[model samples]
Target: MTAELNARLEPTGERWTLVFIRELRKPPEEVWGALTDPGRLERWAPFTAERDLGTTGDTTLTMIDGDESTPLPATVRRAEPPHLLEYTWGDDLLRWELEPSGAGTLLTLRHTLPGEDGLGPMVASGWHLCLDVMERLLDGEDVRAVRGEEAKEHGWEDLRDRYAKMFAG
Candidate 1:
């Protein structure tokens, strides 16, 4: 992927918000299923929801892998099915907005960090790859979740450098 398609970061007071916009060749409903359905999420997302994340409810999102596999508490701030879904992942807030665009869906992901941290590039790179995997899944490609070393081996470092430059200034 090119740097132009990379996530864009904006300084919001003490916090930094990253926005990733992708035009998918699928309907909003299909994309929404991939985002909220645990089965589909496991194919690409870093975590899996304990409960159905399709409504305005609370759920536990268990990290796929980590030193401590503790489930993080998450609360749905907004859920409008196939349109908008906002939730809190630990201290950060993630908002996904979907709209009909031509024959496809315009998906926008906004992740707001609690503060300006040097980990922005890494996080952006991870999400960049995650989104790419998600898109490939939607395109009927059987791709598995890529993280940690697997991510680095899949050009994540290059993405991280590009994202760092984009977020630098």
Candidate 2:
């Protein structure tokens, strides 16, 4: 399935926000588990979490780019199980809101970045692939994570261009 590029920008004090929404066919709890559980996250997320995200506490998120790995200090600010989750990844703030939508869940993510580095489209494209893989995994499909440079094989650059055009006008 082609993932929709449903991303928008908003002003939030000193930082900018990338508001993204995706509708999943899975229940809220299932989607919440994929977002919070380290094992489940590894299956779809681009980074690996050091601890369970269900609890509000300090954690580390390691981004593996080829053989290079960068460890970023992160903290779980709020975790309300199947409803809400707010966390900080390095200098960026990510807030997740989940609502039950019929037999599925409507997932909303607000990614706040420092200043306006013009990274909104790039982040939006990256998240589009991540959510696509997440949707496949939740649908009981065995698929490898298409991230980083590997994302080019999955039309990430095209998606990014699309987002860029949308944001520019």
Candidate 3:
């Protein structure tokens, strides 16, 4: 756990940035697989991801609104399997950096928003939910559906609070 999980906000010219870091009791390759593999991503994320992962070329990741079946375009900037993944959403940059930590892996997520306006909160919640789903999936838990509603209703601050309580032992 880190300060990023507290919903700490960083000022970025016009936009705001949110960061989240977690240490998993799993290998970097396993974490990387869940993130870069479409089959694994669909097991955790709300939308079914379709991408040409494990390749050098850039790919598009869409966050499909399951209810509406609409796709939100997400651009993949860089994908280095088992190491890093960077994607762009609107004016935000979503990055995942993985490193081996002791016997597990340390995952750091940096989500930068373009402005401190409406997009900030939405992005925060979205990232929070995604992270939550990732956490569960990594633990071999079943989290098939998109839990966006939790983020939508609670907002960023509430998301942190809920995660703290839900995951706290």
Candidate 4:
């Protein structure tokens, strides 16, 4: 939870959107692999994609929330391996952009929600912890995915409050 908040919000009509950025100490290819591969995703992401997200096609992702699982019908609208990938999980769009930065990879995640429900802080905090878990997994550290209700054990509430203040001021 001590990690700096790296999320910014923009109002688009009646919808709310946020961009979460993370710098990983790995190449784009490696980072991309983590993003598209199902196994790698399970190691960090809160949801699990049924197939490799590196391809442009239809796929299903299951969002894990405690003991409940929500099946989200998704489609990969754009897929440029090792660089950019855009997909839809249900009605939400998730666009990922990766760029090489001094032997590392700069990851940018653009997530758009349905409405301006003041949920930016909650979403940003979730992504923050997920990205942190991803970074550690990329570094060969054995860490499980920290997400959903379980994220509270990993300081999600604190992150949410911190992000709320950040977005407010």
In order, candidate lDDTs are 0.84, 0.90, 0.66, 0.90
lDDT of 2 by residue, 1-169 (tens): 6777788988889888999999999999999999999988888887889999999999998876656678899999999989999999999999999999999999999999887838988899988999999999899999766767888888888998999998888
Worst 10 residues of 3 by lDDT: 1-10
- Could you tell me the TM-score of candidate 2? 0.96
Q: Estimate candidate 4's alpha-carbon lDDT, on a 0 to 1 scale.
A: 0.90
Kindly give the stretch of ten consecutive residues in candidate 4 with the minimal lDDT sum.
1-10
Q: If both were scored by lDDT, which would come out higher, candidate 1 or candidate 4?
A: 4
* Colliding residue pairs in candidate 4: none
**How much is the lDDT of residue 68 in candidate 1?**
41
Kindly report which residue stretches of model 4 are placed more than 4 angstroms away from their true locations once superposed: none
Per-candidate clash tally: 0, 0, 3, 0
Candidate 3 deviant stretches above 4 angstroms: 1-7, 117-122, 150-157, 160-169
Worst 10 residues of 1 by lDDT: 1-10
What would the C-alpha RMSD of candidate 3 be, to one decimal place?
Answer: 5.2
What is the C-alpha lDDT profile of model 1 across 1-169, one tens digit per residue?
Answer: 5224557887878897888888888999999999998899888888888877888778888876544465889998898999999999888889999999988899899889887757688888888888888989998998898756678877889988887888777
Error of 1 at 21 (Å): 1.0
Model 3 residue 161 lDDT score? 53
| Cα shift from native, residue 152, model 3 (Å) | 6.2
Model 2 spans > 4 angstroms off: none
Pairwise TM-score winner, candidates 2 and 3: 2
